[model samples]
Target: MCDWNVDPEPSKEKKGRLARARGNLARRHSERLLAELYAGGTLRARRDASAVLAFAVALVVHALTLAVTAGGIWFIVRGWGGWGMVPGALLLALGWSLRPRFRQLPKDTPVLRRAEAPELFALVDEVAGTRGVDTIVVNDWINAGVGSYGVRGRRLLVLGLPLWEILSPQQRIALLGHEMGHYVNGDTRHGLVVAAAYRSLITWHYYFEPGEHDPLDEAATLQLIVDLLYVVPRLLVLGVLTLLDRLSMRASQRAEYLADRVAAQAASTRAALEWMDRMLILDSAAVTLGREVNRTSLNRPRGKQQTDAWAKGLWERLAADLASVPEREHERLRRVGALRAHSVDSTHPPTHLRHACLQIGEATPPAVVIDDERDRRIAEELADARTKVALQILQDGY
Candidate 1:
């Protein structure tokens, strides 16, 4: 069985020793690889800032519109019934108070039943125990969309669908290792603080801002108006959050690198990196295929099997051709134009970018292979066991 038990009272020195051991186990060029990972994190932070700026501009424009409209509101509300402007203002204020800072944590968080999968819990606990840190709390939730989040107090929000798809046992270990790095590095706290600040700003912009009032109506009309208004500020906040997310993603990428390094030290960074690359490729392929299916369904002509067959056949051929290529070839096959086609409106970076990061020597230095045979055997065994455990948990007679 997988070793899930961790001593709750591990020391700092012990934690450091374990980390070093893990790092060296892969025999990678530790110093250089670490630098590259840190640098990538910095880049992600910059991108997150860009997203925030976009949201900020939108918020300002909204405020100005509200200000201009507010002047005429005095005239408009001169003889209105009901509670005059008070009720409208109150409701608007209340709605703003509840707006999410970033979109709800990715949607799939709820689906990955962590409670059922005991090994996953043990895995996280082991890392935390080794680090001499409190075990990060893991919970499942279906967020705005499917995604996981690391919060303060060593808390982890795992999206059900995303987790189900993302990693193998070794890769999952590496991913968890990366998350532990965030906890170790205080990133979880940073994320929460940033989120809180963004929430506060959004609350202020929506509720207290004098410019946001409806002119003749006293309140913003339509759900869209409220949505739009919220979007601007929230988007601004999301922009910031996105920036931070990118930063976090970058940080996450770094953490991935580090975890790979640790895994490499223990086994093979190449294997870990390769695993990550495959996972990303699969995610991108799934997204692309889903989009195609959705668009086809939406635009399909109102007809039966005969009319749909030709178009369906054409799409099938195209999909088959695309799917025929190896996952590693996604970057090579994806054109800049084609990349644009895929970039409808995703907060996360492009598939190629993720793919590019997964490539060794872009920023990461060369990793040394330890006992490849041993590592391979252990990885396979762990993976098979986890898969069985995960499957049983999923299929449990509830």
Candidate 2:
């Protein structure tokens, strides 16, 4: 009377249409939210939503873990020698093993001080304004950010020295203003909680893996049972993690937009746009240049000075190449779009989109100017510190 079988697949065109519709919907939703946020008075709501979601996820995870542990204990007490006890004991052990560990903030990079680089320190102070920065560190990479560190919870402003070398004085000020904006907006506080939750989910997922053997190695029936037991639970946990991660990422992107607006106010909108564009170009070039440097560095045993010189030369060449690109070619480059596309998991918007937003904001003068004398002084301040940092990099063979 009734058909039990059903079609298991959809047409490819149907699937494509559904995917496009979903993409359009999501894009429209994000645009509306961004518009409201930029118009003002929505950041608090976004922050609250992020916090509540993070808290809810944490609560559910902990409650599930506790319930499993309690059930395990009950089985152990009621039937100590039975098969029920075995699973109960295993569940308890799993819960215990997967408990989140206190994470340590990494501290391998060199810390720069006001005494060592007064000019740079003065520049930082001017950019930072009233913000409190506990430490200033130089990293070897081509990105910069602000974050809290260690048990003492010191606020750190980490500058990528290489990126610093590439940017003009005004661009550097725009970058610093953007980073300080994170502190001003209380993003770092919310960020810590979200980061902890993400780390916990990641840890749980890792614990769900079948260790040292494939479930398929067993007989078909046993393998089926194992798959039903392990695979299903893993997928459920992964789904929850994906949902929570996207929520956190959306909050982060909002924070980035707000920070960009702050940069537009504190520094020049034009400088902010220029900084982002230069960063996009540098990021693309860094990958190829980094690979070449890595290969070349490994082939020879060189002193710190020599290594530094080689790295500087490579950077200079990369900069030269960027500068030599024609204006028309630069326009073509934008057609490829930003280095990273806007996505659910991405923390930053696309460069073009950021530029568009800044264009709508009121214009401001450049926050800082670098004359030849000022540039020379800044260079001198970094000279010794750069050598030391270079030596460290060479010693680490990176």
Candidate 3:
């Protein structure tokens, strides 16, 4: 039977080779920059006045957008003819859409208040130093982050319960120290001007990005014209993005290194090292957790699914799964990270470089410690949310 309806997808490995080049370049750049900074024997990066160029470019982007927006208004007002209004409307729509937007915490994220988790807040306040955290939130994932959100730039802390459950108390403090470090270190990539400019270029690139189109489709010749028109603009947007990235990224990577230093200082060298070890096994941990959940769900009746002990025992099983991974596997993971200069994302430097940098520095004792009594008390505060998250994970089939 001939399957004329089927079109086998292109090989991902083949496509990835070409498509991943840009990311590969960025990673190499990160490695080089980290090496250079470390060679200077300084953990902290001094402010670079040259960052003003990035800010200037950002202003230019905003000015261009405003000019286009004004031109759109002029076109509509003059209305060269009745149908002349069409181009005006299109231009207006595009210019307006390209404007930067304020970030807000996701609606699905569960927000925790100080009253609800005072002990958790105390730990956060101590680690954060000045205590500007506006809200704390939790989710089911195995990651955590801190970010500014809302018009006033209120700080939001995201705690991933799965990862939190696996971490020791000091490791938890280390994690908090790292995130708070981003803010205190003053990572310039997140600054309003450069960040907004970068955002505009990304949007522009998306609008002009080329894609496969059928020649036999309606108005195919017009589509070809459109594709041709997109090429130059798309290239320009890409070039600008590259420029902005080059200007802002060095500072960002330095921030990451500095944050690691802060983590070590706050939670002790041992705790920070253990924290890094956990990072290396994140992929394996996620896979094991997923397998466990799937196995638990298998052949279990929907009605009786609620009777499952997910809330009571999922974390224990997950921790055991991670603990069982061989030390040789951990070494292998480190080698892989070193080979590729692995990072959590384009925004971070290579994780292995970070870990190695910490090892060579002086060992420090933890400034803050969470004792058994306090740890248990914090857990008591988290009991309701913990059970709810576990039930939700089970019901939602994660």
Candidate 4:
């Protein structure tokens, strides 16, 4: 017999408290680990610890989900044709509903071959040194990242053509080195798995999420009852997942610092610093440029020649803006802190901190030369592809 009349509020409260305590403990442990890494712990030590923790959590989650699913099925089989079957069937349905779905890496973006962009490939090789590269993908956004894809876990380097157009040759080298650093430090390998696990947990929570119900509605009573049955457990699960995500993010930040050190070593420290500052400057400039492009309908290019000319003009303007910035103003911009401090979920450390870290280490001179001809050739090769992506963005009204 079930005690349906019994109040569930007390149990809910207890679970809430337990979840909060666990979250706090996880946060504290993560912060302590981060502090140790910053204070003097080796990057490999911190990385290995975080990777182990993430893999353990992921395994536990998958195992628990499988057990619940199997138990539900067994109950259904044993309790067939009776009132006992109701609970078994319900449990089975819940387990199946919350099962994690397959997540595929994005494949819509254009892929560039080494033969198509030999100069760009040369730069990548120069920056990466002995590191192996599976592919280089070019997109239209002002972002870049290194990712592992497919069952064989091939490493892919995605570079934004717009970002490439703006950066000087030395800055480009620094950017490549920083991205390759993620691969070198094993951030790409372990971080991707942890991220996928975190995302799956979040997705599962949202799958069974209850919608808002009006308190005055006749069905509100039943809705409230269902909420009591469902929401508390979901919240507890989500809280734990959130805590794990925070730990993963802490590891990601440490990886960023390590990658920055690698970048500084591979490229000049000055180049790395300048590259970071350029990101901030470019972000601001991009906003203004976007508005102007929207107002002028820059996407409605009459022909390839027109598009190429407009792109060239846009690059010239951006370059002039970057070149005109006074050193003192750049320094001032660096000193002014962000309005909101980075939360535990943030993957990268603050730009100022990254700059300071780079300053600490001795750096080799940038291997790539600042050749305008090479930059021009790379830009020309990517111009048509960038134009197509830009048109798609405008068509989507983004």
Candidate 5:
């Protein structure tokens, strides 16, 4: 992911001890990589031995899916009318689902076209230094980023509405700048082969993942046997994931530093610094996005009309809520972030380090400024989208 994936808290399922331990390890790994990179002053055109091995491992994972597919086809062809058909059928289904491929945008993904959002596209273009992105989109989130989608090398811009609604015009530019910067830097995770490989492993891991509870009619002993059988394979897959993550993230941390440098150029050093500052409290927006809708619904607006009004004003309410946050709270978040090394993920460098880097880096004027005219037009363009997202949030009750 190009961004902190929105700085949301780890999902409930991922809050287990194993996950926390993994996260802490990732944090430490990123920190060490950042320090090493900074000290080496080798910002670009460097790939360590481990990175090459990781690439090879990624291809192996990708090919394993293909191998499963081939094994299925062979069994089906060789044993057309025999007992082999049962396992063949299962393997076919599993292998097909596990195919390595780019992350395709959902058919229902809400998109903004150049024609529909000229002002917004103008800002995007400016942030990108006239580079064209394949898509600009919105979703229910408190984050934003640029990522590649599909095998054709198309780039996507996804703005988290809650994040967008709260940002200043310049901050918005900074956000786009940072994400766009990822394309310029060496974001190995965006690579088709590597990304697809990682995703395939994730799917495989999830598929064979042992259920916390057995099926109602299943025998416990049988389930235990099945689970025990999968334990070794699952552990092996997880180990590969950890190794790949560690290797790729070293480069990813360096890329983050480079992207921040680009962000500084795209939206000024001051804006980039402010961007890091805002990153510390992204959790607040995520929390508010969840609570605002549920709290409003709980308030029990009398009828459809009242509910619709509340939904329409959702962004305004969210913005106001953020505006009222005290500086002390901001400082507190910064402290907490520092304690955790201030990471968005294991891959990205800690916010404190990036912030300090920018503080001491060059100062520049913003390439694209967000004035009242620009802000008003972009907001007008996204008005329906904002309302729709609000309604979706209300409907989803999150």
Candidate 6:
């Protein structure tokens, strides 16, 4: 396990108190998670609401379509029950589309044997211990290759690539603290509950229809009609779900704050902040480069001769017309497009805001724990890459 020498000046009593407080919070969070998971009725209610809303709207649409086709208001009531089949088809499609992602709890024991880093395991044990919960498994494979901080099997996965390339030991500790916070707080169960609710919503119309309407019915035309009628209700439900997801994200972000506090309590606030910054930097770099690499591979130069000719002519023109332009000006021209893209579509609410949240009330200037020299160099490199990208955008007039 990795070792740290805490500042001896801070009394052991204070550390003990913070540890106790952190444990209490983790326990409360874990309990809440378990409650949410086991509370299937609540999820059923949400699902029922979605199904009823979709069916009612679709049923109305079907009635209107029949009324218009027959060209008589009196026929609407006579054939209204006939339109129930349309809602049924939509219900079937919805059920299929919104099926729960996982059927059973994922196990993590097998993943632990493959994990290479001893330090990460130690950190995980420490965080789990603080919550008074013993983890059955820690997954090693899923860390950097996919999204971070997700629950899978019975194991908590800390991606190896992200840990190895992006984080220092302190940052690694903070990252582990974040994941453990999710586990301790019962994020996995809440996630499953939400998924189940969504699934149940899709299947709701089947139960409410007047006659037996099969969601698994094979009639293409009937299904299409139902699908068309269900579109509005589907959109409405999706919009609401999107809002809920955003709310969940907000809650998750706050949980991140608590986790950071936990990590800081065990270690240092400065360490927590440093880890956050590094994660942002590494993630930004990965997204940018990963996009470009994927694009390049997919767009392998199919027309080499024509491209070469165009490139040669463009270079000659640039050399002749912009020879005296400064490197900074060229760089600015390249990145203008990427800057616009970042501004409009970025999911994260600015890095500085995240950093500020972590440093709510600490000493005058927070204690430094990591290597400033190396971090600055990495930052400079990333900035330079961004500058080049900006210049490319500018030259392209994007």
What is the C-alpha lDDT profile of model 4 across 231-275, one tens digit per residue? 777887777676575556555666777777667766678888888
List per-prediction Cα lDDT, in the order shown.
0.40, 0.63, 0.77, 0.65, 0.76, 0.41
C-alpha TM-score for every candidate: 0.40, 0.72, 0.87, 0.75, 0.87, 0.42
lDDT of 6: 0.41
Candidate 2 segments whose C-alpha is farther than 4 A from its true place: 1-30, 35-46, 59-107, 186-190, 209-227, 245-250, 291-308, 311-315, 338-345, 368-374, 388-398
Per-residue C-alpha lDDT of model 3 across residues 179-298, encoded as one tens digit per residue? 888887867777776788777787888788766678788877787889899999888887777777777667777788888888988899899988988888787777876776687678
lDDT of 6 by residue, 359-392 (tens): 5566223222335664454334333223333233
Q: What is the lDDT of residue 185 in candidate 2?
A: 64
lDDT of 3 at 202: 75
TM-score of 1: 0.40
The C-alpha local distance difference test score for the whole of candidate 1 amounts to 0.40
By lDDT, the better pick of 2 and 4 is 4
Per-residue error for 89 in candidate 5, Å, reads 1.2
**How displaced is residue 58 in candidate 4, in Å?**
0.8
TM-score, predicted candidate 6 vs. hidden true structure = 0.42
Model 6 weakest lDDT span, ten residues long = 337-346
**Model 6 residue 131 lDDT?**
30
Full ranking by lDDT: 3, 5, 4, 2, 6, 1
| Model 2 deviation from the true structure expressed as Cα RMSD, one decimal place | 9.1
Candidate 5, which ten residues in sequence have the lowest lDDT sum? 1-10
RMSD of 6: 18.5
Q: Candidate 4: lDDT of 293?
A: 71
